[model samples]
Target: MTTSSSSSATHGRSPAGLDVSASFATTLHTPEHIRIAEELGFKRAWLYDTPQQSPDVWMTLALAAERTHRIGLGPGVLVPALRHPMVNASGAAALERLAPGRVAVAFGTGYTGRRAMGQQPVSWAYMTRYVTAFRALLRGETVEWEGSPMRMLHTPEYPRGAPDTIPVYIAAIGPKGTAIAESLGDGVFIMGIDGVSEEVTKKFESVVYGTAGSVLGDGEDLGSERLRTAAGPALAQLFHISYELGGEEAVKALPGGLEWLAVVQETPEAERHLAVHHGHLLRLNDADTAAWNAGGNTLVGHTLTGTAGDVLARVKDLAAQGVTEITYQPAGDIRRELEAFADAVGLRR
Candidate 1:
């Protein structure tokens, strides 16, 4: 059963899920990756939606839909500012036509997408309105947008009609966003296990924990090249977000954070935003490599990396804490990481 529907009586453990970066390198192969996940018993495949850093989310999901039969497909957390509500509704509808009940869309306030463009996240109020409008449009209802009423106008021939129901999820990290999710969303997506609170576990039916790292093999050290290649992108992301949210002072507080900040600051101010997220979730860039060399290993404990048994223990702990699903984003060798994690979680096709 999918994690969303899994319960203690029905399953022994929480379901494992996969999240992929919709980068140019992975977009074409994502369909194959999702197919593998389906074969390995992964319940869902969430694609990243950062236009500046990767290809179109919907287009990539559509491709995945055509390739896989059972795995759920959707944007992990689509940024509301990137597209209008009508546009998002249409994309979700198109995917619904292809995947039917397998589609679920999650909306976020544009943390990475907006920040990469030298902007701040959208307010919670705007996100709520956008989600409300998108849902109404999917239900064949007219909603006022920018002082005018608009609705989905698709017929049976063109893009076809939207599915009767599409599950909505909200990506939340704090109380304000959690409140919005509790009010409107069918589930909640969080960055780590700590984000899944007692109130959230009770309020939301599905609490998906998103994380990135490798399942370390026997005798593998965090400082090894393989481990760095597999986990460095995610580690570097923390620095990127720190710099974006708190600027130089905040980033410098991290391990190797000072040197990382220095390298990032070397970029011209006008293009610094672009530099910060150059590789994003796909791989590490030059600045990231420098940070890793300086002292990034000190922050290894913060990631999901561990031996197979250790990782499994972590997953069980999260499940016990009411995290219904764990979506792991694998860097470097995607297939190897997926297989290792699936095995560690005892998933079967």
Candidate 2:
């Protein structure tokens, strides 16, 4: 189950769920695939977006919403700078209209594609302000600042408004971004091949979440959700964790697997990009395998490089740390990998 369906606040515990996603491929037989995903016991479906080589995240999600009923849907981390906030605001509103009560949005600072295009990163302070403002707009509130009034464009022919009650998840990486997530007092979405340390997670919440003593207004659970406080979850990463632990076969799937191995030897920054780049390369499955392995651009550090059982156990261990949502990028055929995952994690009812 996802935080949306958790229902644990009444009992003083957090709820947990999994996020199944891939950022590449515009259309993955989505109508059929998402249904398969729902049947496989996946909690929710997450989509990703980039300038080139990847499908439009929100567009794919709106399409997927028509296919699945019980599962949830949203962008894993749509970078705000990619387009006008109105684009995101409008797209989200429309998706909610179609899927009613099943839409959520996650915003992140984008790691790879945007930088590849010569775009500068959006400032955290600006993002914090923009997200705060964006949420309000999505809630049917008109926003105005410095004598300028702004409201989303609407029309009778194609009328839509932001859902009054859509959940907002923030993809906060690194210490700074994480702190912003906590201070804002909303769901914090984070996943790193190398687990983002608990101390950092705690420090992040202390600043972002602790800044204000009260849960900012009503209908928001500031204290519980900000720090992945899902109660009783023991294998949140059966999905995302698959990438890191897949080991040799996983590494062999990268764009420049050998190159990344060398880069990480000198400094770990390359490993981080390797995870992002190689994930895109393999998940899309567009690059030739022979070229990818021989080339020097593969993503290697993201690989778990361990036995399947160890990978599954690591995911379980992390869930013990309070992760509620695990977003995984599968290595082989989607259907087969999910089955292997469920068997390893015992995810059946």
Candidate 3:
């Protein structure tokens, strides 16, 4: 089993990373986007894994792998509930073949991927078993799954044989998940700066903080059309997560949460799951738009959005707190967001 150790005190500033939602539009253009990010000195390209909302995560990562030479590539958080452990192991092996040491995989409890399908996140125990089995398969060891022995059957000549190593990161927001991450994951992936606690920074060698929103331009404010367009999709995602985790009462706690709940409530309870996440991280659907028009602007402060300098200051603070990496998910003009953020953070090799 994986266990955490005290990270080296000499760890430097957090490097910048790009997070792509893997929607059709984003997927089609990810190669170019990642190339631009690479040229701009990004450290990694993490594709979201939402089968209901986008193409296959592994396929997208494979495409990205073939296009980029250096930038690290992998899913931001693979939902184990969506695939057997063997399938995930194979997918990681394929990417390792393409990118060699450039592959890194992060596993999560299926927040959007499972919730959108009207299900709860998988238990941490299940995640532990799946990740253990996955690592064993990649190591060319036979592992039992559902009472059957399974292992990679690739010949040495095949490109699918496991590479030297693939670092595993677990996405966690709470203590239970974080504890599991420390015990089982090589690193931990989390959302928001608030997720970067002292215990996490000290426990894990790599703490990847994922955020969405844009690096604001010179004259832009929260109400600026460009800011709205760039930040709306991700801003709305907060409401989706809240509603799913806490239901109507929980959503009512956000800025304009009551109004947002009303719009979501308009859909029948039986099929509300479909209605709540219509656009997801791609665009703001009707309910999300309603939330934005009402008081979503007020929530911008809670996101990664800010003038370039302001965002950079935040990044520096996180680095001081021991965050190893920060992955920014852009909502609009993907290339523009990537370039702007890279420049803002002074990303370089």
Candidate 4:
């Protein structure tokens, strides 16, 4: 998995009268990066589950756990389809042994993970089953899997036999996924806050779910050239996702959508996944940045890119909309953007 730092930082509130907290999200950073985030006062660190591009999430989290103290650490969202629920249950239990109460695991329907294998996301029913069983396994309780009853064999070694202390966060984009999260997960993980409807936010509020979403860029102005360059990779991913998931009409709805669609059409289908996620969480190349910039019209529609104050305003807006936490995911220079976001949100060491 990759690295993505997120938390419902109730330890303090921002200066905007919003109780929301700021955190960081990384896709391919080492434990040292997570240590820096902890020092920067981010309440938690999330590791993304992108096996196609990053190292194993559990190993990385283990390293982070060893290097940092006081910061919450867990997989931003682990794709259930990639591993057996029992295996993940053991892994989560092991991680909790290392980090104790600081561990949390989120489950996603497998976006990049499945795409890399040339497959589609697993069904909601399948995910629900996995989560239910996984939760039980973490509780060190016997659960009916497949046909017979099963339980973690080594529960006697650990006090609870499972990592019941770990919270499970569910990543959802639609009503079906949200419903699964509400029923089976302790929290909800969203990609971006723009598409989250008021009705959905109300549901999340009612459950007091710890919500986390991506904020793409940073600058002194919302429409600054620098902001565009910084936010390019994320914007490109959006375009690619729209085209890949929603087809030609969806692409048409985006800014310079048609042009981006052409870029995808020209590429061999097999390579599209890698191309869309190029420089992902790291840095975008000049050509990719230009293509992403060309699709800039759709940037503001979903991303939170602007001056510090602008970003703060957007954070306030999100908090009002019921988002308890924000995950700042910037491209280009990662530390510069992380420090800028920390400064903007008044999160100090």
Q: Which candidate has the top score in lDDT?
A: 1
Residues 1-349, model 4: lDDT tens digits: 2233334344334664444322333444657777776667676677777777778888888888888766778787789889989989988888777776778788888776787567888899999999999998878789998898998888355644238867887887788988888888776777773355667766664222232212344324444565565666555666667766887798778777766666656658767665555555445544345555675534654566656676778777777777766665555555666677677777763
lDDT: worst 10-residue window of model 2: 207-216
Identify the candidate with maximal TM-score.
1
Model 3 residue runs over 4 Å out of place are: 1-26
Clashes of each: 0, 14, 0, 7
Candidate 4 stretches with Cα past 4 Å from truth are 1-12, 17-28, 155-162, 205-229, 285-287, 293-301
Q: What's the lDDT of the predicted structure labeled candidate 4?
A: 0.67
Per-residue CA lDDT of model 2 for 146-216, tens digit only, reads: 35767866777776744767777777766777778776635777645336466654443211110001111
Residue 121 in model 4: lDDT: 88
Put the candidates in lDDT order, highest first.
Answer: 1, 3, 4, 2
| Tens-digit per-residue lDDT, 1-349, candidate 3 | 1112222111112343222221122466677787677666566788888889788888887887777776777888899999998888889999888877778899999878888888889999999999889888888889999999988898778756444378999998688888989888889988773457877777888888888778988777678888878888878878888887677888888887877888878889988999997877788888888888888778887788888788878887877787778888877788788777776776532
lDDT of 1 by residue, 197-234 (tens): 77777677788778888899889877999888888887
TM-score preference between candidates 2 and 3, better one? 3
Which segments of model 1 are wrong by more than 4 Å? 1-26, 159-162
Could you estimate the TM-score for every candidate? 0.91, 0.66, 0.90, 0.83
Model 1 is weakest, by summed lDDT over 10 consecutive residues, at: 16-25
lDDT of 3 at 286: 86
On TM-score, the stronger of 2 and 4 is: 4
